[model samples]
Target: MEMQPATDSRLELWHELMQFYIREAWLLDERRFREWLDLFTDDVFYFMPRRLNIHRSEPERELSPVGDLAIFEDDKTYLTMRVERLETGMAWGEDPPSRTRHLVGNLVAEPQPGGEVKAKTAFILYRSHHETEENVFAGYRDDVLRPTAGEWKIARRTIVLDSNVILAKNLSVFF
Candidate 1:
C-alpha cells in the first residue's frame, strides 16, 4: 500500500477506522466474546509482552517480547478457545462474570505496505467483580489491520501496558 496523500477522504477513512475500534470496545464491554472474536482475522497474532522497569542505562532491555515472558501470546486458535471457555460458563475466573468498561481513544492510522493499516490507540479498561474493588488497566495497542470483505479485521495486535506490576488478581478480561 503506497502512501496516499492526506485529504478529506483520508480523514473520513480514519474516522471509519475509529468506529471499528469503538465497536470492538463495545463488544468486549458487553461480554460479547464471540462478536469480538469476529473482528479479528483468522491469522491474528494478539500479544501483550511484559513491561519491565529497568535502569535507564539499560533502556534496550526494558521491554522484551522475544524469548521472554508475556501476559498473552495468543493466536486465533487460542483466542477461539478462550471464547469457547467463556461460553461454557465454567471458567472459574470469570464464572460470575465481571462488569467491564473499555475506553479507547487517541487513535492514529497509517497505511502499511500490503494494503493493511497500522493503527495505534490508547486504552483503559475498568472491571468490577462481585465483591472486589474495581481494577483499572491502562495500555496502548499497536495493531495491523487488513481489509477483508469490505471490512477491516485485526491481523496483529501488540499491547503495551502502562503498569509494571499488575494489581489485579486475574486477567480474565481482554484489554
Candidate 2:
C-alpha cells in the first residue's frame, strides 16, 4: 500500500482547528459554558480518564481507557446534566462558584481517516477560592475532531493529567 501524506489544505485546516481550540480555551476561562457547548457536536464524547503513576521499579498495571474512573465522561446528556447542576443551587461543589482560568497551548494535530483530525493540547488550569490562593492542575488532551454542518466539532476527547493525585479540593470547574 502506498503511504499517504497530509495535504497542504489539510495542514491549513489543522492550524485553523488549533486556533479554534485556543478560542475555546479562552471561552472556558471566561466561564462561558453555554457558548463552549456550541463548539461541540451533537454526539460529542468528552471524557477525562484518571491518571495513574506507578513506581519506576514496579510493573505497570493495565487499565481501561475512560471506561474506568474518569473526571468527566460526558455526552450531550451528561453535558446538560452538568449545566443543570451549575444552574440549580444544589451542586455543592460549586455552591460558591470558584474562580478558574484555563491556559491551553502546545497544540499538535494529525490527520486521521474519514476527514477526522486527532489533536493533542497541553493545558494548565488555575483555580482560586475566596480565602485561598490559586491552585493549578496541568494536563494534556487527546481529541478527535470531525467536520459537521460545515464546521469542526469535537467528536471524542480523552484528557490525560500529569499528576496522578489531585490536591484540588473539588472538581467543580470545567477542565
Name the top lDDT candidate. Answer: 1
Task: Summarize candidate 1's per-residue lDDT along 1-175 as a digit string, tens digits.
Answer: 3455779978897899999999999999888899899999999999998889999898887778655778899999999998899888689888889899999998888876889989999999999998966899998999999999999999999998998988898888997
lDDT of 2 by residue, 22-99 (tens): 789788777778888887788988887766676667534422365577777889888878877777778777767778
Off by over 4 Å in 1: 1-6
* lDDT value, residue 12 of candidate 1: 90
Q: Clashes per prediction?
A: 1, 0
- Which residue pairs in candidate 2 collide? none
Q: Which stretches of candidate 2 lie over 4 Å from their true place?
A: 1-11, 55-64, 89-92
Each candidate's TM vs. the true structure? Answer: 0.93, 0.84
Candidate 2 vs. true structure, TM-score: 0.84
